[model samples]
Target: MRNSRPIILFPLLCFLSSTISILCEPNTLVCNEKEKHALLRFKKALSDPGNRLSSWSVNQDCCRWEAVRCNNVTGRVVELHLGNPYDGFDLEFYRKFKLGGEISPALLELEFLSYLNLSWNDFGGIPIPSFLGSMGSLRYLDLSYAGFGGLVPHQLGNLSTLRHLDLGDNSGLLYVENLGWISHLAFLKYLGMNGVDLHREVHWLESVSMLPSLSELHLSECELDSNMTSSLGTISEVHFTALSKLKVLWISGTSLSFHVNSSIPTSGSGRGFLSGIVDTAPNWFWKFASYIVWIDLSNNQISGDLSQVVLKNTFIDLSSNCFSGRLPRLSPNVRILNIAKFILGTDFPFHVQKMNGRSKLEVLDVGLCGA
Candidate 1:
């Protein structure tokens, strides 16, 4: 009996040892060969002047390459974070490190790639590759400030899984004539097109409101005119009410007229315009003021007696506006308040006098006010 047990145990020990060796093997994991070749092809299409992608080589495992991420088990490339490391303001550093040349269609081969960021790079003002719309697995796509010009490809509407999309700040070069395609992004949560010309997209809001999942919307410097605002007013209240999940709304530096209603749900909201004409702040606008965390109606033609208005937001910027009479009462939680260039009377509002002790006021800018 003892001899038989030793023989059986001997075979089991050998099997365990072989399994351990296989698991412990170094450099056993490598990215899929097809995907690796795809990445190499994609890199070949780009001009990396700073050698930022120097590690991208056929000899090295593509999984180990810079700005490339792969699944731990499947070894499939899932993310490409080729965004410029330097800040946008650092022009010298950007010029030295930026990637240019055409974005190759090879990226379409990465069927598992879910995130792609090519922001802050220079692409020589070329149109965004329309083929990008075919990458169905993409959930996050950022091409902001990437020097892409001309019309934004409507084909991007095909990305039904996209949750975050930013095509902003191309120095006003990117423009979209129609946004009807945006309505196709059913699952989109954040949409940013700041500085992109949307002056021609008259039905923009209608397309935007179609996204029930949207939380953050940024359209600053889009050159939106009053016509869009008028169109917005025409949109049924049911459409605005559908944006219950919206938390951030920024439409600054345009010619948009600000109108508030019970349907608009927002935590951080700002409305800037070149010719926003509001004779008086609507009483209903104050109805949702308590839910707002930030409010900026600066540099507009808003005129009213805001003494009756009470702002509970943490930040309030009503500067460069034509608001007259006494200042609005600030809530105890208000931290930043700016009313520069207001026509409020020479006498300081009672709230401003009491702000020193009653509120959490930190940054107060009342400069150029009549007071």
Candidate 2:
């Protein structure tokens, strides 16, 4: 319940006794038999740290195993969770105990599966199979930090019931050839692909922006930049017109110099912009960009005062730029603004009083300014 993995395994004898007691009920017995197949497949895939899963002996029934949940009505295996089982294990120990293997294809056999968390594992370089998308009942799919690669399968679009999808920290996935696949997913509410590289599938960025149901989008390094400049180029007025409901967009990028092995100034509507962050501005932009609440151009050569900013919920940043002018008068609704290390002729407003009036203007990082 804490990490959302199953943690309820009773002793075999107790389970057997419980099963025997329930055997008299025909429906109960039938449900148990139906669930047995899924449970068997689950046993084959489990790799536990602390040898706790050793108790998941083939000799014993898995109905009593921890980290597995069955539907009481249908008696089907509906949950398979594997995450940080121990809160106190040191990093090295945790790594050793971590599970690593292909997500068994047999998972498709368990049609009732509703939730899964195979995140933070040492499962290196094992790509998620394409069949995973066909599991229409899957509501939660988390494959964070698995080091798996390959394009995110287009089949994932088939899961109309999916609500939470986290493919964070997966360096193995370098391309996204099927952007249209995810656009049809109207049910998805929370999407996380932090540190995922979209350069291989930049088209998906444009395609995914069309989803009307998307609310929370978390795409951090999605490339390599610590700043969120690379992601800016992906937004065209044509693509984001329907994203009226969107709230958060967090991309990552490098410093002002590309010193960190990233893009310096994103250019072209769809060409030079890096992955997660977008630093450079294309020559033209439509007025619809005013919809974005936050614009983080922290580490790039973005020149200009915050004058161009008009979004109400935004925290515009011009840090590490060549901007040289008076700090722009921020709207009362603005939140965070960073304009550090600029090659400018003006200075950070000495009054600091302009900031006190706005209730939402929380963080103001003006480091290394010439003011």
Give the local distance difference test score of model 1: 0.79
Give the Cα-based TM-score of candidate 1 against the true structure.
Answer: 0.83
Q: What is the C-alpha RMSD of each candidate to the true structure, in Å?
A: 5.5, 11.0
Ten contiguous residues with the weakest lDDT in model 2: 252-261
Per-candidate clashes come to 0, 23
Q: lDDT tens digits, residues 1-371, model 2?
A: 67444434446667888888887665431235545565566556756555645655455454455666777666677887766453224677666666665577677777888998777776567667789998989999988766677777778889999988888777645346546777777878778876666545545556667678777676654443333334434444566567667666554342322222334444433423332332334323313334457655444444444444344557666565555545555667777777666656455542233543546777888787763
Which ten-residue region of model 1 has the weakest summed lDDT? 261-270
Per-residue CA lDDT of model 1 for 31-93, tens digit only, reads 999999999999999999999999999999999999999998999999999999995799899
TM-score of each: 0.83, 0.69
